[model samples]
Target: MGKLSFNRLKRYVNPEVFDFDTTEEIPPLEGIIGQDRAKKAMEFGIKIKQKGYNIFITGITGTGKTSFASSYIKKIARTEERPNDWVYVYNFEKPAQPIAIELPAGMGKQFKKDMEDFVEQLQRDIPKAFESDSYDMQKSEIIKKYQEKKSELMEELNTLAKSFGFVLKDTRTGIISIPVIEGRQISQEEFQQLDEETRKEIEKRAAEFEVKALQIWKEIQSIDKQARDEIKNLDNNIGLFAVGHLIEDLKGRYKVNESVLKYLESVKKDILENIGKRVNKLEEKVLEYFKRDIYLVDVEGERVGVVNGLAVINLGDYEFGKPSRITVTTYPGEEGVVNIERESKMSGRIHDKGVMILTGYLGSKFAKDFPLTLSARVVFEQSYEGVEGDSASSTELYALLSSLAEVSIKQGIAVTGSVNQFGEVQPVGGVTHKIEGFYKVCKEKGLTGEQGVIIPHQNVNNLVLTEEVIEAVKGGLFHIYSVKTIEEGIEILTGKSFEEIYDKVYRKLKYYYGLLSNKKEDKGDK
Candidate 1:
């Protein structure tokens, strides 16, 4: 075939574009499925912070790191109690960190101060009540005068009773004694004994005095009631006014401590300075971490070397890159596989190395019963030196399964999706980059007709394949298959239809139209 000049080359037609209304609701961060491990990690970090430990979450963009972290933090903030509260700092990706401040559970300082003042006023007033010279003395004087007036009225009733001819009795019958005159003179001893009439006369006088005293007592009680009522009203008015003044005074006194203010000022300065220092330290740490032969692409999309002598990459523009050294540093060999029989538990180390490894080994018959052994070692093959993203989680699952099943996955086809223990395939992030990365490799290798990528069906909408990749696919040089479950993915990756591979389970992979499965189930039942 004759080579065509650049000027004579035919231009490709672009797809006709029209905007369509998308009423589809974007799922909340919690609704995201198949990221239980990542979500749990974020939750743990939040718990650590709640226990007063600062945390830093590291993950590639679109891995839901920020969303998960923020949501978890917000949950903690909503439930916990503290003197001061948490603040969310977003836009850390920008110059100014956008922040949301949350107040604590109880009343503010001003209100607390007012309460304290109210108690203090009560304490002071209670003591003054006992002190005779205090404001209560006015009420006491009124009481004393009422008592004196009542005594004088009782004295007048006694005089009136002497003039009356009857004596009053103390019993409820209200009986009175009347005088009786007897005409006999007796001896001194007999006279001393006195006549019944004289005695009766004296009893009658006593009864009259009791009646007069009772009437005067009733009158005194009426005056006393009026005086007591007036005093009570005065006391109430004073109390109300005092309480109001105390509240206002306490509020006025509730100034932020000057020393605390100064200390906070210093703290703010130190925090900013410390943040800067940490930024520098983090830069150095990241640089050192990646120093061992990694090929990182700079912000301009140019390949750059990472080594001890090279300047540290700026965090602002640094993207994911693969490690330069293709070293299988995790497990040495078959000896590296975990002994399941020896320990029924999976170590934290294994748990951190992606859930796929644990599931794959546990699921396989070869590794199932006898120490269900498996190595925690895994990495992206030929992924020389760039930051790895979660987009490769599915690939990790496939590789892990291949290891467990002793089945070699074709390196010609790349896979990208998350997987659960039930062997269900789930959606992942960066569908575009992952596909393009494989596409780049395939193009360099002279794409065989069989070469293709297996991606989750949910990610199909995100397929904005580059022109070159599209051309290759159309030309039958490459292909792409969308699978909803792990069974479908395996079929796609192995170039065997589900029916041909696992005939019995093939029906399970059939798509159910118009039915939505619970996404929570896909998130490891979290």
Candidate 2:
């Protein structure tokens, strides 16, 4: 077969032909670039807003799946009137089960702030109102009235004791009375001198005084109850004065949402109940960091056993495209293919499978009759995280084949696509983001029109690129080459026929096998 023309092999993109200074000149893309099909499905998902219609955005990660869905939902969310505010509140009936109060669109923030302001105002106002002289004076009047009633009860007890012919006296221990001769207490000796009838009469009178003392204590307890009830009433009146209008104003703001209104009412009561208790600690808010791109496009020269591979990486709460160099080295051994990532336990099952398939492709092409005697090791450079997917399979195979054929791969071109055992290029996810990623790296390194990406032809359908990429492609400052088979990719990379390169690889494998055979024969002789 003829070699792929140099023109068809590398597409050119001139980023400067556009009338813009930098990418900042282009407006930010509104919706997903190449997913018109997903748009319809996503629109349906966003519009329904019903239960059980939840959209599961499943594609490969870093295909802009999460970002696209979020932006699209937000775009559709702006126009339609949906009350989507929610607040977690203490449920009085079930304190452990908090209630989420839903309010109007954009009203959750307002409600939160309003509630905070109300609490802060109460915090400042309630203490001051209780501390005021007027409140203290009213509280003292209640105490004074209680004390007057207590004094009257004590006076009644004294009068009752006098009627019993004993003088009553007040002491810290309790009320007491003594037998008196006229206005004075009788001496102990004189009391004994009295006849038995007189002593018995005195003891009975003392018993009557004790009963009167118990009645006075009961009356004092009644006054204490009245005083406590009166103070509580005063507190309620002051609390209403300080906080009632504040709550009413909040109610008016959230009148559109009955759920929010109900929540606010409950909150008002809770605030009153929890007054004087310091507020609970505020919850911590998470702040997201901006992650910039970290790959550089090599737009000049050529290197053997090196091919650019695209991958997805997650940083904090966001995902982005990362381009890594996959390198391969081959030797004559029975180990077949040694995957460094697999040995280090940094590759996923799918990635391990891809590496295994690389050995299969080599076996089919180079050693059909006898065992494949070559061993190869493949590694993704600077990769520490667990790598998955067969997306980089084709890229890695290119690097291996280049090493075997001793042909240099063009450094300017980055590549992505999966490969089957038949060496057929398969479509991968994030085709668009992968393109943009290499494009940015190339642009940052100083765009060379010769730089481009080789992608699977089947993935062309999934391409939805940004305006800058389109402009660069149109202007011939950048390029995107779509290939169908590994043979076709090989022809483009080496600028030679697929048969010519494979023949070289085949000969090299045979030469190694021939040496192994000779060494075995010499050993038998020895």
Candidate 3:
């Protein structure tokens, strides 16, 4: 099995077969370098608009799955029409079921303000209508008519009482009939002095007069009730006049919106039913939840111990990727590598393991000359949410290395990938998303052709970029580089070869080792 015939093993083609002198002289292949099947599948999924024809992007973490999905969506969203704003209003008929109304963009806020203004105007004008001179005059007229009617009823009762030898009198106890003898009212003691037969006759006549007076009193009570009803009707009519014009104005404003017209009608009816009630003002203001901030964008200058690390922020229904500054600080010590995120309990176990791998990488690369005698603290600056992946392992390493070597990495570029102890850059998920995210930031800050992203070489096939990014790349406004090793990434970041950086880092570690050794010697001597 190990041996092969000369004809089979030594098959060779003529040099004349190729037209180009060298590979560099030939034009590069078009489109992506690999994964033809993936690219085609993505294109098909993105172009199809039918429901249930969704594209399921599956890959290990850091493969750029979310990056691809979000980039395409955002690109398409830019060209689409703005969505309608939805609002819920109180349903007077079915209070438990609030009605949902859809309004054109920005119209929702206008509708809300208009309703508030209507209520305020009603509060001001309704009270004025009730307190006006015309309303008071009308009210006084109704009271005057009721008083005249009561006077007439009282006169009729007095005449009836006189015929019965008892005159109707007005007193503190109310209208009463008193006994009268010889055309003059008599005291209770004189009335009692009369004989039993005379007293009986007087009592019978007074009882008869009381029956007639009771009928007149009932009539007077009915008139009082009628007057009250008239005054109430006047108040209702005045209230309606004060608020009807306001409701009509609001209806005119939302003339074409059937839902708004219906809601306003309900509101008007409710207001008139309970005229003097005050409506509470809105307590919360409309806040924009999805907005861009330049804080996470990359700066224009290079700095030591700092590298732009990419990350994905998922806020369900609105997920996005952005860049975070990963910073490292190194000093002479035996503590190896200290992850500030882990120390503060803001790092997941995977991230802690990634940091531990940094120690392994440092020892493997530079420990032959001296023990890895350095204290390195790594952190993602301006980050509050806990970091949870090994995706930024390469980014953290670059920052640590830059800190150790006193080298500055370019701020215009971002990086994502996990690294092994051998310093090989390994693939991480969301590569497309991370790259696109950084591209967006650089674009906002203004692309300078020098801005780009360095990703793991193994993740090259994960790219399915938006048209905007593709155009930017075609115009040389941005770039993307796939790296196989930490050295390759560092060279791109610092604009220096891997050997030069290694020399600088090794010398610093050697210096640290010597300084610590000298201090120990001095202590032992003392």
The lDDT leader among the candidates is 3
Task: For residues 137-255, write the lDDT of model 2, one tens digit per residue.
Answer: 77556656665565566557656777888755322233446688776556568889999999998988787667767767777777767765675566677777788888899888778
lDDT of each: 0.45, 0.74, 0.78
The ten-residue window of minimal lDDT in model 1 covers 302-311
TM-score on alpha carbons, each prediction: 0.29, 0.45, 0.48
lDDT of 1 by residue, 329-391 (tens): 222123442322113322222223334443453345233223332244543322312222234
Pairwise lDDT winner, candidates 1 and 2: 2
Please provide, for model 3 over 174-229, each residue's C-alpha lDDT reduced to its tens digit, 9 standing for 90 to 100: 45577978765566889899999989999998788778678888998898788767
**Stretches of candidate 1 above 4 Å error?**
1-353, 364-376, 381-390, 496-526
> How many backbone clashes does every candidate have?
17, 8, 12
